[model samples]
Target: MSTARWVLHLPAAATSAEGVDRLAQALRDSLRHVPALDFGELTISAEDDQSTRRRVWCDAPLGGDRRCALRTNHPDRCLDR
Candidate 1:
């Protein structure tokens, strides 16, 4: 089987990177039921500079094909959901 990637550009009223990250997390949480959505791979970028992206999740490999469920750059130890 083949998998395809999809990108959705959402415009938000957040004024800072942290605010945007929160918005992204809320969106992922609301859509958690969708199996096709890879919450761990979530990212955000400025409207003008899509080339530079900021990750929303830690997404570190946690063995057995599991990934960290913490936010990006989290100070605590990685956890899997």
Candidate 2:
């Protein structure tokens, strides 16, 4: 049987927000040498504030449109709006 694996594409540390590197390293360290699962390419991305307002489109079996506004750092504040 083939082993299951996941690929991750990490963003450049210099361009990404602060603490992204630490977060990536934590994920990498935790996911290493697992029994049934493995991962590759832990990717991070940096986007402008306006970019977050755009919709995200999914392809293939998961085809759909998603709004980025639904995601926020402050969940409590979301309900106030």
Candidate 1 per-residue C-alpha lDDT over 1-80 given as tens digits, one digit per residue, 9 for 90 to 100: 88887876556757788788788888887998988778887778876887998788999999997899898899999998
RMSD of 1: 2.4
Which one is best on TM-score? Answer: 1
Q: Pick the candidate with the highest lDDT.
A: 1
Give each model a TM-score.
0.76, 0.31
* Whole-model lDDT per candidate: 0.83, 0.37
Q: What lDDT score is found at residue 3 in candidate 2? A: 86
Worst 10 residues of 2 by lDDT: 54-63
**Which residue runs does candidate 2 get wrong by more than 4 Å?**
1-16, 35-40, 49-81
Worst 10 residues of 1 by lDDT: 6-15
The residue ranges of model 1 lying beyond 4 angstroms of the native Cα positions read: 1-13
Give the distance in Å from residue 8's predicted Cα in candidate 1 to where it truly belongs.
Answer: 5.0
